[model samples]
Target: MAGTYSVNTNLIAKLAELRITEKDIHACKLPAYEQSGNLVQAEDDMFGRTQLMTPATLTSWQNLKKAAQDEGITLLLVSAFRSIDYQCELIAAKLERGQKLSDILSVNAIPGFSEHHTGRALDINTPDCEPLSEAFEETPAFTWLEANASRYEFGLSFPRDNEFGISYEPWHWACRLLD
Candidate 1:
């Protein structure tokens, strides 16, 4: 993926504040994502938080959700479009709770490196599953996504033993831009 945003001094400083070094960033296989400047309000998530995404992503998400609904599956949005600052805050909070940075980094991408910064990634859940849990893979929604999400240009970001070294997140999907 091409990054439209550069790692400026501010982002570098933020990463440093969170104890992330240039070596650490380079070591991660995930690419840095630029925050989308043309995001539109997609919808309210399960927790009533306003979610935003690129217009193309929003259209694909709606179409994907409708297709799933037509097949008696329900996909609920848990998260979308997290900012670099928000990612930093999440990591800082975990650190404050005494979690090891290495442990936290496995799950949460370091600041600007998160796919969420691109406004194309989503965390989805179904009514029957716990939000953000690996148990989501057991749901019919997951099976349906595995079978059909590609038709709508969405794909699971991290499956078992993904190249990025991130944990397997069954609920995290990203809408890929067509070339």
Candidate 2:
């Protein structure tokens, strides 16, 4: 046989076009009702933890939850749908916690680039546990996700090989095109 041929660039180009667009993305902002009716009441959950999400995201979470339950794995929603100000506060707190500004920028997405800004993204936890870690990712929660998340229209937003600007976040998951 002659030399093997590589994949065609034209085919790759066609495939790329099918990918989701920025416009289809939705950022976590003040909820509609909160924006117009209860600005003062728009508060972050105690200690900056919250699990609010857009309808699309909630649906995805429901699916994920159901699948996890079917397999006897319990996954808890730790944080979701953060507002711009809430993000700012989080950044400031991290800064106060002795993290260098540059270091913060490296792993954490700037306000705009934050998938947390998109109501579709979530940071999950186990019962009474804190922020997620590799230990958790290798546990029942992550295993359950690996087995069923795609079926529920959720995907690991940042993996080791992610092209996204952010670092790999084992706990973060994004819902199908936040459109």
Candidate 3:
């Protein structure tokens, strides 16, 4: 199945051309967020918000979801693979509503810097939790993830006060499938 997933040539070229490091990848700068690739929606046998992930990412996520379910924790996907274009449109829509880009950037990641562009980040919530909010941390699903997500190679991509300066999002999780 891994063969079905090819590396994002554009992202590699962008990274190579820009010489971005790990720290740069997390930066809010425009150069850091430039990426493009093919995507596939994965909803078969899954629930909640439909997700788009690299085929391999979807496989790993399925494994992780099963683990959560075995523990009686049903995680709901709130968001997933988002194209840089879509993200930009979202920001544009916000701007149209009179929201400042700086304020939007504080909450929503600036395009390419968003993990959702990589098709590996997941915004998970429980039936009782609020999606994309810190209140999710109080849910049993969050507790289960905190204790066991890493076992599936999934980890919280950002925590409170993370260097990226984005707001705390307890529902966000990422699969570092590449490394």
Candidate 4:
């Protein structure tokens, strides 16, 4: 489980030669929306539109799903790990669509600043429930997570209106350990 900042010596030297200072290294954690590594037991085992979660994230998500199922709630994955290049492409695409870089970075993380870089985050949804919007934080799943995520070693990286600068992602969850 290599982390986002785990760069090789060769790459380090190359970056140094380019005068890319540490302050310039905008290493974003992988977003909960992008899938990566082996988050799921089966590669294709998606709850809905989301896919490509690491194994650890998938295990925790499954546990949460089972608990929800037992309580008559249906949970689904909406998105999960995007590659660095993919994210760059996304940013480029957004800019092409006329979105300002500053505005985009405010809501969408700048490539490396995303938590998905760590392969520990996930985005979830509920079936027959309204698709997750900014207000999804008020839903039962989000409410359930507020109380129960800690039991599964999962946590909400961004809480409601916290001073973290990053926007709140109610559907996002991350593992406490790689596992």
Candidate 5:
């Protein structure tokens, strides 16, 4: 071996990119996420795997799944709890790909401001529905969630033109403990 070489340009690049102006940071206005209860990895379902979530949320989710199954609606998981670091990396990749920060923010949440950070939010879909699309609202699973998820203390995070700048995500549900 000749000489060992070490480099960390990637880290440097990340830090440099994060050196955003006050206006830019203000424009982002990341969401505030709250955490409660112990987060545990969700039990695998028919659709796919899940990330870690609160045990209470998990129990409600399991119950929701059972009810959906009983009604012949097998809900699928598109996403669950995601760490802030992961969100940062995801946004960074999008930014690197020449996507506008506003455009990216319209869809994905900024690291510290994601509902997924609370281990309470989850994205769901059906095997027959398009993932993360409005079409999901037309699916039986969405309909089931709409009709019954409330019983499990789950509710949709967004509806078309609700308030937050983020786009409507019909598949995104959260189990917020009303305190």
Candidate 6:
């Protein structure tokens, strides 16, 4: 994975701007992900925002969604591909809102380190639940995903006590790249 993605100077500067040090990067348990260059538009999210993902991820997500639907569950996309710049903006917004940097980093990955940059990660939800809340774990959509998402090559990225040190995110899943 190290050889797969090289962090550029701009990203380094951005991390510095966010007050993320080399020690912070080294402490992160998750691997850095390169932003996908080959991405296609996926289905519009519940908010009607267009999402993008790698072609294989899009196909797998569609299959997973269809299978869930067949089982009387509905999966809605909340987020997909996100650029390093977008990641920076998210962190900056949180910082401006007075959130501690450490708290922010625990949830949102530093720019260039987010799995969302890979275009294979998805934040999913079902109707009647908060989009990114831990309560999703109790929903039928999450139960269906836990039992069946692997059939489409998707798996939860961060679970309870995950080594990534990220918070438990029941709504986040990522597709395995066949390539």
TM-score of 3: 0.76
Residue pairs with backbone overlap in model 6: none
Residue lDDT tens for model 1, 1-179: 23324578888899999999888877777877787777889889999999998889999999999999999999999999998889999999999999999999977888988888889999999997899999999999999999999999999999999987888999999999721
Going through the candidates in the order shown, the clash numbers are: 0, 1, 1, 26, 1, 0
- TM-score of every candidate relative to the true structure: 0.91, 0.65, 0.76, 0.72, 0.79, 0.92
CA shift at 116, candidate 3, in angstroms? 0.7
Model 1: which ten-residue window has the lowest total lDDT? 1-10
Ranking by TM-score: 6, 1, 5, 3, 4, 2
TM-score for predicted model 1 compared with the true structure: 0.91
lDDT of 6 at 82: 98
**Could you tell me how far off, in angstroms, the CA of residue 129 lies in candidate 4 after the best superposition?**
4.8
lDDT of 3 by residue, 79-154 (tens): 7788866776776688788886557667766556677877777888788665677899988889999998888888
Q: Candidate 6 residues 2-86, lDDT tens each?
A: 4224667777788899888877877777787788898999989999999999999999999999999999999999999999899
In lDDT terms, how accurate is model 5?
0.72
> How well is each residue in 1-179 modelled by candidate 5, as lDDT tens digits?
11111213443344346443334434543345544346788866445565778888888888998889988888877778887667778888888999987677677754555788788888887887778889998888887888889999999988788656567789899987532
Please tell me which model should have the higher TM-score, number 5 or number 6.
6
lDDT of 3: 0.69
Tell me how candidate 1 scores on lDDT: 0.90
The residue pairs that clash in candidate 1, if any, are none
Which sequence of candidate numbers ranks them by lDDT, best first? 1, 6, 5, 3, 4, 2
After superposition, the stretches of candidate 2 with alpha carbons farther than 4 Å from their true spots are: 1-50, 94-99, 127-130, 177-179
- Per-residue C-alpha lDDT of model 2 across residues 1-179, encoded as one tens digit per residue: 01112224442343234331222122212121111111121124435643567776776777778778877888777677766456556666787788875666565543434666557777776654556565667677887787788988888877876654445678888777444
- lDDT on C-alpha atoms for all candidate structures: 0.90, 0.58, 0.69, 0.62, 0.72, 0.89
